[model samples]
Target: MRITLHEVSKGRAGQALPSMSLEFHSGAVRFALAETEQRPTVLGLIASGRMKPDTGRVTIDDTANPKELRRRIALVDAPDVSDPHPDITLAGVVGEELMFAGVGATPLHARRWLTQLGYNELASTPIGNIDPAARVRILCELAVLRDGVDGVVLVAPDRHGGSPDGWWRIAGEFADRGYAMLVIIGGSAAVALERMQEFEAINASGPVQPLVLEAPADADADADAEPADEDAEPELSAAEPAEAAASGPWVAEAVEAPEPDPLEEEAEALREAQGPASSIEASDTDTDTDTTENGAAR
Candidate 1:
């Protein structure tokens, strides 16, 4: 599969994309998640080929219409489940997707994918009854049907329902089968960084790009603060050494230290000085009470 974007820019409500251009080819999997307001336009370019730039062109295998070109490409968008036929079973929906792409869906392949994705029990259930994660898995399976498959595109927000290991496992499967993937996401930099690291760790040869969506000016301030705010919290693993270093000297110094608060020391001293006077007052009061009782009896 080969993809090329030339100065593709889309605008909405006064903001425009950064006049982006990129390309992806076979034997390489490129990952990018849309951020900012351009997410929809980016997705549109991938899905319907409707968001093409006025000044430039997007070509897939030399075809101008990405959607038409996607016939040879397996495209997976999780939200596209909204268009699933109400009466179609989960397996049926997957079968239809494969069939529409001119691929035959063997029962074995469908069952394997459904079970691997934790959707085995819902294999016969309607698409509407299946959960989002299951839908995502179905889309992933469709992306990589058999070895030597032509092209595949998978798009979803980051933090999809899967453990880190699970995510890497699926990604690895695609890479192993030699399918190019495009991931659309809305998440923090840390999350995106972790994803890129996962891709590199699995296949050192894979191509991945973190496309940060530029938020509005006011929103960018808040987005910029998120990392700093997270950085302020000390990690347990990191703080332990610092704590030990600080404690050693502090403990030694504290051993010889006087009262830290002068007012507390003064109050303690005052209480100690008043102790004898209070005891004498108590004795005098007891004697006066005894004398008063004796006088009353006489």
Candidate 2:
């Protein structure tokens, strides 16, 4: 199945989108490099079936209603919309997704996919326990659990640092398995795109071009638009790495856990040893009696 968007335009906070059009063929992979805000608007419009092009149309294999094609389309790792809860177990996350899509969560089916994706060990682990790269892999595995998935759109694939070619490899895998893949990267993301010769790419992050607005009397009608700052680009220092994301596997920055005080630890241990009986007594007894007992003990 193919998906096509023609002349689609959207506005966020009154800023209009620039001539955005996309086409994803079956068993193919496509990439879109866009500004942070613009990516979500375009992706959300396609996912929710609410996209109405100001001039053209969005169609999936000739079908107009995107809602009807929901079963065959999957949006994985989309910012804000489809993010997996960090606290949920990996299995729980996938199980809920399977149920939502009306698929059975049998051990064989679930395990097979997880293992194939090199994530079986993390199945019982919470999503927060795994690295960002692993989280992306898990979501992709969940997308193909049901049969006949025509397309999968991944937003902000560069959030997790991995092989510069990692996403392209994953997309190629999906394409080989008969699913069209669309990977959206943020304009500010540090990923390198030189290795993506096999995929088609669209650049949507440039300065917004003038378009005939649907409403003429909107804001900024008289004010001159400011020119982009040429000096905004940072000069690289000799010590600073040019491409950090491409240098190695991105391990998240470690947070310094507070050291435990001995007194606090002892007090906590004492409370645990006292167990439910102490808690019950303190809660159930009269306030006056408890105060008197505390004074007598002291």
Q: Best candidate, TM-score-wise?
A: 2
lDDT of each: 0.58, 0.67
TM-score of every prediction relative to native = 0.48, 0.56
Candidate 2, residue 72: how far the Cα is off, in Å:
2.2
TM-score of candidate 1 to 2 decimals = 0.48
Task: Show where candidate 2 strays beyond 4 Å.
Answer: 12-17, 47-55, 106-117, 188-191, 195-298
User: How does model 2 fare in lDDT?
Assistant: 0.67
Query: Per-residue lDDT tens digits of candidate 1, residues 1-298?
Result: 6777776666653255555666666656555545664553355454335455655677877778655554555555544432466568878877766665466677666776577767788888887665555555566676555444465555553434444344444655665676655544555633755776876787886666789886799887776774555435333456466556446533434334455898888999998987755445544354554435557732
